[model samples]
Structure formats: structure tokens, C-alpha cells
Target: MTDAIADAKRAMRAELRERRHLLSDHARETAEAGIQAQLDALIAERDVRSMSCFLSTTTEPGTRKFVTDAVARGIRVLLPVTRNDGLLDWAVATTDGDISEGLFGLPEPVGELLGPIAVNDVDLLVIPAAAVDASGMRLGWGRGFFDKTLGSMERCPPVYAVVYDSEVVDEVPREVHDQRVTGVVTPTRTLTLAPTRR
Candidate 1:
């Protein structure tokens, strides 16, 4: 990545993080509810029998409620476990699954680890992103875990990034390794971007 692109990404991520930190409690609650509804609707629309999702960090758009509800509905949900080698392992989500802080202090499942390939079986993927642009390019947090996962997949399912409504911007910095998502889910709406992957 060029220095200019890297610097741009850092600035964008910092600005977004600050915005999330400043969100009012009421705003957060409202956003969470909206996100849950949008996600539930997406699941139903896609007929997603199995899928992968991330446990939201406090400052990210909330997914815990959606995760719990999906498991309750008998959907096979897999939560990510960060691996030391810059890849992610998967774990089956349970309604009563234990959560513990993993690498980067992100919330992770405390269940039997399913290897990285476990994600290949999913019907869909909902991932975390600092921001996503109109053209579907996703700006992930500095780490490339999701990028690598998406890049390595032989046949990736539809991938969506969850962010606050404001984070869906006109454009964001992108690198060749940065993976684009099929759509984006925000507090107010879900948008399907033009598909760029084969």
C-alpha cells in the first residue's frame, strides 16, 4: 500500500472511532434496534441457513442481539476467533455461548474452535468494518483478518459489513488487498452494492 493511502485510512478510522465514542446512549439503542431488524430481514430474504458473523465491540453497531436471536431460531451461526497468524477460526454460536476477550480485546466465543475452513460452509457472512463506500469497498480496522479470509475463500458467500448509518460514505481509502462487501447494513437501512467479485 502507498504511504498516502495508508495515511488516509488511518485518518478515516480515527475519525470514525471518535464519532462512535460520542454517540448518545439513546442513539446507540435506536441504532441497535434498527440494525437488528435490518439483519433479521436480510436473513429471511436470503434464506440463510448457516452463516458467519462477528460479535460487535461496544463501539461498533450492535450484533449481539441478532446473534442470540439467530441461534434461537435454529440458524447455524458461526462467530470468529482471531488467530495469531492473521487468519480467523470459527466457532458455532450458541444462545448461551460463553464470550471472552480474545486478540485485540475483541469479544470472541469460548467454545470449541472450528478451523478457518468452517466458514466456507456458511450461506452468508456479516463482518465488522470501520466503513464501507458506495462502490462496495470496505475499510476494515487496520488488521487484515477479514481481508485475508475473504481473499482465501474458494467460494465466498455474500458478505456484508455492519456500520452506523453515517459510516456508509461516498468513498473510503482502498488497497488491493482490501476486500469489498456485497452489501452494507447500517442503523437505518441495508444496501446491496454492485457485485465486483466472481
Candidate 2:
């Protein structure tokens, strides 16, 4: 990636982080509810039997509620465990799954470790993003784990990035390895952007 692009991404990510940090408690709760509803609808619409999702941090759009509910509904949900090799391992999400802080202080599931390839079996992927552009490009939180995973997938299912509605921006800085998602789920709605997956 060019220096200009790298700098742009860093600046954008910082700005988005501040925005998330500044969100009021009431706003966060409302967004969480809305996000859960939109995600539930997406699951129902796609009839997703199994999927991959991230355990949201306090500042990110809430996914813990959705994950627990999905597990209770008997849907197979795999949560990502960050690995030192810049890759991700998978773990089955349980209704009563134990969460521990993983690499980068991100919340991760504690369970039997499933290798990287375990994600290939998922019917959908709901990932976290700092922001997403209209054309589907996702700017993640400076980690390349999700990008690497998506790039290696032989037949990826619909990948959606969860963010607050305001995080749905007109554009985001991109590099050659940055992956595009199939859509984005926000507090207000779900939008299917044209995906460029191979």
C-alpha cells in the first residue's frame, strides 16, 4: 500500500475510534438493540444454519446478545480467536461460553480450538469494521486477520460488517489486500453492496 493510503487509513480509523468512544450509553444500548434485530432478520432471511461472528467489544456494535440468542436457537456460531501468525482460529459459540481476552485485548471464546479452515464451513460471516463504504469495501481496526481469512476462502458466503449507522460512510481508504464484504449491518438497516469476491 502507498504511504498516502496507509496514512489515510490510520487517520480514518482514529477518527472512527473517537466517535465510538464518545457515544452515549443510551445511544449504545439503542444501537445494540437495533443491530440485534437487523442481524436476526438477516439470519432468518438467509436461513443461516451456521455462521461466524465476532464478540463485540464495549465500543463496537454489540454482538454478544445476538451470539447468545443464536446459540440458544441451535445455530452453529463460530467466534474468531486471533492467532500470532496474523490468522484466526475458530471456536463454537455456546449459550454459556466463557470469554477471555485474546490477542490485542479482544474478547475471544474459550473452547476447543478449531483451526483456520473451520471458518470455511460457515454459512455466513458477520465481522466487525471501523467503517464500510457504499461499494462494500470494509476498513477494519488495523488487523489483517479477517482480510487474510476472506482471501483464503475457496467459496466464501455472504460477509457482513457490523457498525453503527454513522459508520456507513461514503468511502474508506483501501489497500490491495483489504477485503470487500457482501453487505453491512447497521443500527437502522442492512444493505447488500455489490461484492467482488472471487
Candidate 3:
């Protein structure tokens, strides 16, 4: 059952990737607007004094402007420094001018790399995702990076995953190491306190 489910999920992602580039201009514009609106609302409501968010990639939901805006709001913006040791480390820096491509061709900080910090120290964590279900289960880019890091954290901080409308679906397969987000902000909706059965 697990194998079949995994294969199905992988296939779904592959299919979507092939079609994502074909998105109509109207669709793209609408989605971007909705995402920006959600980000603005979230920013206004929170203190954001100590928030850490990942620099987004093309495959994942985009949060580049969100990160920059956070910095302008006097919030601490953090970038993930992927280490050869297969653990995620973070560096606190203004997501202003230091952004450059990293190992996976994803944008990351180009400044001093800071060491690991407790998960509890982060007031909010912005995670990337391919999809998220109503149960708050986040489906990342199939990389075990987040799973491995989150598996070790004791008491987790509030995590938010950004996703497009289509990716905010009804169900998704989960693994043992899969961590759930506290909420999801989609291009079209903010499913705060995701209900288990939504």
C-alpha cells in the first residue's frame, strides 16, 4: 500500500511539473496576487521580529518578496545553508543583496553561515511545499532535508507552508518523518489552524 501510494504521489508531482509551465497568463497573475495579499495580511498581524523563512525556488511556492518585505519590517530573515553533513543550518541576514544560487540551483544567502539553533527559538518558520492537505501535512520537493531536520527538533515552532490553490488539496500521502505545518497560506486562501478533516 505504501509503495503504491508513493508511486502515485510521485506521478502526480511529475504530471504537474510538466503542466505548470503551461499556466495561462491570467492564472499566473491571479495566483500571484492572492499570494501577495496573504503575505501582507500575515505580516501585518504578526510582530515578525524573529521570523525565519527560506528563499524559494521555481518548483516550490515563491516567497522571495515576502522575505525581503519581512526584513524591511524589522524582522529577522534567515536563509538555509545546506551542509555537506546532510543537516540544515541557518544564517541570519537581511535578504537584501546577498541572495545567490545554491547547490540545487536555488537562491540562498551568500554571507556568513551561522550554526544550528533550537527550533523553539524561531517564532515562525516559513517552509516550502509542493502540496499541502487539509490535515496540514506538507509535501516538500521529495527531499529529505526538512524531514531529517524536523525529526530532531523537540518542541516545534509555528511553521507555515506556501502553496498555490491547486496544491492545497484534500489529501496527500505522509511518511513517518513527515511534519505537519501549523497553517497554510495558499495563493487563494489561508487555511489557518487546518482542521483535520477540512
Candidate 4:
């Protein structure tokens, strides 16, 4: 059963990733703008002082503008630095200028390393995902980095996954170790999920 679920999730990831890659630059920019607007509203509503977010890839929902703007607002922002063991280390991303390519071809900050547990210090957490179901189950990349990190948190703050609007679905293949998100932020809207059967 585990293997079948993994395989199904693998196929879903590929399809979602391919769809993201096919988005045009103009479409992505427009989506980013919409996402940024929703993000700003959420941040203010929640009074988020610090957050851990991912440095989005070109094909992913763009987060550069959001990160830059957050930094400018004096909101502390941390980006993940993938480690050799598949766990992630955190680092300050005070600005958008110091990012560089890191493990798994993802962008990361060059600031002082804050170790893995630094994620616990944030008031909010913004995770990257290929898709998220209406019940708040997130479908991340095959790697278990975010899953492990979230599982390790003692008092996890509100966690939100960033994805395109279409990626939000009614269901997603989930394993026992998979972590659930509190909400999902898309380019067009923010879905604050109500509790559902797990």
C-alpha cells in the first residue's frame, strides 16, 4: 500500500511540475502579483513578525517579490538551505540580492546559518508544494525535508503552502508521515481550510 501510494504521488508530482513549467512568463508574473496581494493581507491579519519561506524557482509560484517586500517591512524572513542528509538548515534572507544556487538546484541565502531548529522560532511558516488538497494535505516534492521539519516542530505555528490556484484539489495521496498544512495560498486566493477527516 505504501509503495502504491508513493508511486501515485510520484506521477502526480510530475504532472503538476510539468504544468508549472509550461506557464508563460507573463502568466507567472500576473499570478505572482495576485499572490503577493493575498500574502500581504494574510501577513497583516496574522501580525506575522517572522516567517520561514522557500525561495521559489522560476516555474514555481514566484516568491522573490514577496520576500523582498517582507524584508523591507522589517519582517524577519528565513529561507531553507538543503543539507546533505536531506534535512534543511535555515538562514536569514533579509534581501533578495544574496541568493545563490544550492542543493537540488534550489536558491538559498548566503547569510549566517541558523541550523534546522531555527524554523521553530518563526511566527508563521510558508512551505513550497506541488499541490494541496481542500483539506490542507500538502503534496510536496518526493523528498521528505519539509515533512520531517514540520514533524519535528514542538509547537508549530500556522503553516501555509504556496502553489498555483489550479493546484488546489479535493484530495491528494498522503502517507502516514506526511504533514498537514493549516492553509494554502494560491496566486488568485487564499484558502483557509476547515478541519476535515484525516
Per-residue C-alpha lDDT of model 2 across residues 17-59, encoded as one tens digit per residue: 9999999999999999999999999999999999999999999
lDDT per residue for candidate 3 within 1-198, as digits (tens), equals 389878977986786666667777676666657776887777567655676678766545567777777777777777787766767778776745677877677677888777756334766677777788888888877766776776677756667788777887787778777877878888877776653211
Candidate lDDT (C-alpha), each: 0.94, 0.94, 0.72, 0.88
Clashing pairs in 2: none
Q: Residue pairs in steric clash, candidate 3?
A: none
TM-score of each: 0.98, 0.98, 0.86, 0.95
- Residues 1-198, candidate 4: write the lDDT tens digits: 488998999999999989998999999999889888888988999999999888888998988899999999999998899999988999988864587899888988887898899888788888899899988899999888999998888888888899998999989999899989999999888888844212
Model 1: per-residue Cα lDDT at residue 181 = 95
User: Which residue pairs in candidate 4 have backbone atoms (N, alpha carbon, C) closer than 3 angstroms, thus clashing?
Assistant: none
Off by over 4 Å in 2: none
lDDT at position 5, candidate 2: 95
Point out the worst 10-residue segment of candidate 3 by lDDT.
189-198
Candidate 1, RMSD to the unseen true structure = 0.8
Judged by whole-model lDDT over C-alpha atoms, candidate 4 comes out at: 0.88
**Every model's Cα RMSD, please?**
0.8, 0.8, 3.2, 2.1
Off by over 4 Å in 3: 24-30, 193-198
lDDT of 4 at 153: 85
